[model samples]
Target chain A: GDQVKQSPSALSLQEGTNSALRCNFSIATTTVQWFLQNPRGSLMNLFYLVPGTKENGRLKSTFNSKESYSTLHIRDAQLEDSGTYFCAAEAPQGGRALIFGTGTTVSVSP
Target chain B: EAAVTQSPRNKVAVTGGKVTLSCNQTNNHNNMYWYRQDTGHGLRLIHYSYGAGSTEKGDIPDGYKASRPSQENFSLILELATPSQTSVYFCASGESQSQNTLYFGAGTRLSVL
Candidate 1:
C-alpha cells in the first residue's frame, strides 16, 4: 500500500493562475515535505512541514498530522512552475527515510 | 545549501550487464538511501545505510545492491541488469531521524536495453 497518495496525477494551468496539490497518507506520518522536480529533473525542496503551514515565494504547504494529509498550493503560477510535484512523508516510529508519492505533473503554459 | 551529487547522470547498458550508480554528499549525514522511481511505483526504496560500511535492505532490494564505503559516498549496483530495471534512481542523505531533512542528488537515469 502507498503511504502517501498524491491527487490529480496530472494538471495544466494558465500563466498567472493558481492551483493546489494534495497528498493523503495512510501511514501515521509526523512530517511532510513537498518537492518540485523541475524541467531538468532536478528536485528542489519546496517545504518541510510538521502539522503546520509554510509559504515561500509563490508556494505554500500545509501538513495535518491528525488527518494524515498535506497540501501544496501554487499561487500566480508561471511557465517556470511547470514540473512534477511530489509529497513525501516521514513517520516517527520508523526509519528516517521518506516514503514518496507517485508525483503530480503540472504544465503551466501561457 | 547541502550539496548532493550523483555521477553518470545517464547510463545505457545491455541486459545482464553490471551497472553502478554513485552518489556523494558534502553534508556529513548519518543516513543514506537509494530509491528507484517508475511510472507506476513512484519512488520505491531499494536500500539504505546508517553510516559508513553499513547497508540495510529496504522495501525493494532483491534486484539491487547498495554499498556505503565511506560517509560521503554511497553506491547502488545492479549485478545483472534487466530491462525491467530501467528507471530513474535517486540518492538522498540525512543526518538523523530528528533532523531528517533529506538532501537529494540530481538523479541517475538508467536504461537496460
Candidate 2:
C-alpha cells in the first residue's frame, strides 16, 4: 500500500468553479505541506499545516493526523490553476525529508 | 521567501551516458533533498544532505550518486545513465534537522534517449 495516496489522479475543471483535492497517508504524519507545480515547471508552496486549517487567498488546506489525511481546496479556480498538486508529509519520528503523493493534475478550462 | 534553484531546466542524454543535476540554495538551509517524479510513482527521494560534505541514501538511490561540496550547493549524479533513470528531478531546502519547512526549485526534466 502507498504511504500517501492522492485522489483524482487527473481533473478537468471549469474556470471560476471551486474544487477540492485530498491526500491519504498510511504513515503517521506530524506535518503536511501543499504545493502547486505550474506549467513553467515551478512548484509554488501553497500551505504548510500542523493539524488545523490554513487559508491563503482562495486556497485552504487542512491536515488531520488522526484521520491520516489532508485536503487542499481551491476556490474560484482559474486557468492558472492548471497544473499538478502534491501533498508531502513529515512523520513524527523525526526526519526533515518528505514523502510525496502521486500528484493531481488539474486543468481549468473556460 | 527562501530560494532554491536548479540548473539546466531541461536535458537530454543517451543511454549509458553520464548526467549530473545541480541545485543551489541561498537560504543557508541545513537540509537539502533530491527527488524524482515519474508517471505513477509520484516524487520519490533519491538523495539528501544534512550539511556540507554529507550525503545520505534515499528511497530510490540505486543508480544515483550525490555530492555536497558546500552549504549552498548539492548535486545528484548519474554515473551510468539509463532510460529508467530519466525523470523530472526536484531539489529542496529546509531549515531544520527534524520538523521543518521546505522550499523547492523549479525542477529539471531529463530525458534519456
Candidate 3:
C-alpha cells in the first residue's frame, strides 16, 4: 500500500477556471509540502504547511494532520500552470525525510 | 533564495561502472537529501544528511552511497550502475529535517546501459 496517495491522477482545466488537487496520507504525518514540476522539468516549491492553510498568489493549500489529507487550490488557471503537482508528507515514524505522493498531472488550456 | 545546483545535468554509464552525482547548496542548510524519480514510483528518498560528517539512509538506499563532507556539498555515488538505476535524480536542501521548506535542484538525468 502507498503511504501517500494523490487523487485525480490527471486533470484538465480551462484557462480561467479553478481546480483543486488532493493528497491523502495513510501514515501519521506531521507536515506537508507541495511542489510544481514545470514542463521544463524543474521543480518549484509551492507551499510548506503544518496542519493549516496557506495562500500565495493564486495558489492556496491546506493540510489537516488529523484527517491525514491535504488540498491544493489553483485559481484562475493559466497555460503556464499546466504541470505536475506533487505533495510530500513528513511522518515521524518514517524518519525525518518526506514521503511523496505519485502526483497529479494538470493541464490548463485556452 | 536558496540555490541547489546539480552538476552534469545529464549522465551516461556502462553497467558495473561508477557514477557520481554532485550537489551544492548556498543556503548553508543543515539538512540535504537525494531522491530518484521514476515513472510510477514518483520520488523516493535514497539518502540524506543531517550536516557535515553525517549521512543517513532513506527508504531506498540499496544501491546508493551518500557523502556530506561539508555544509555546502553532498554527493550520491553508484559503485556499480545498473539499467534499473536509470532515472532522474534530484537533490534538495532544507533548514531542518521536517520544519522548513525544501528547495530542489533542476535534476540529473542518468541512463545506464
In angstroms and one decimal each, the interface RMSD of every candidate reads: 1.5, 1.9, 1.7
TM-score of each: 0.95, 0.93, 0.97
Task: At residue B93, give the lDDT of candidate 1.
Answer: 90
Candidate scoring better on lDDT of 1 and 3: 3
Instruction: List the TM-score for candidate 2's chain B.
Output: 0.96
| Per-residue accuracy of model 2 over B1-113 as CA lDDT, tens digit each | 89998998999999999999999999999999999988888788988988999998888889999999999999999998999887899999998754477899989999998
Can you give the lDDT of residue A62 in candidate 2?
90
Where is model 3 more than 4 Å wrong at Cα? A93-95
- DockQ, candidate 1, comes to 0.64
DockQ of each: 0.64, 0.62, 0.70
Tens-digit lDDT track for model 2 on A1-110? 18889998999999999999999999987889888888887888888889999998889999998998999999999998899999988733333788888899999999
Candidate 1 segments exceeding 4 Å error:
A91-94
Least accurate 10 contiguous residues by lDDT in model 2 chain A? A88-97
lDDT for position A98 in model 3: 80
Q: Candidate 3 on A27-72: residue-level lDDT in tens?
A: 8877899999999999999998988999999999999989889999
Q: Mind giving the per-residue lDDT tens digits that candidate 1 earns over B37-102?
A: 888667888999999999988888998999999999999999999999999999999887565788
lDDT score, residue A9, model 3?
94
The residue pairs in collision within model 3 are none
Q: Rate the local accuracy (lDDT) of all candidates.
A: 0.89, 0.89, 0.91
Instruction: List the pairs of residues colliding in candidate 2.
Output: none
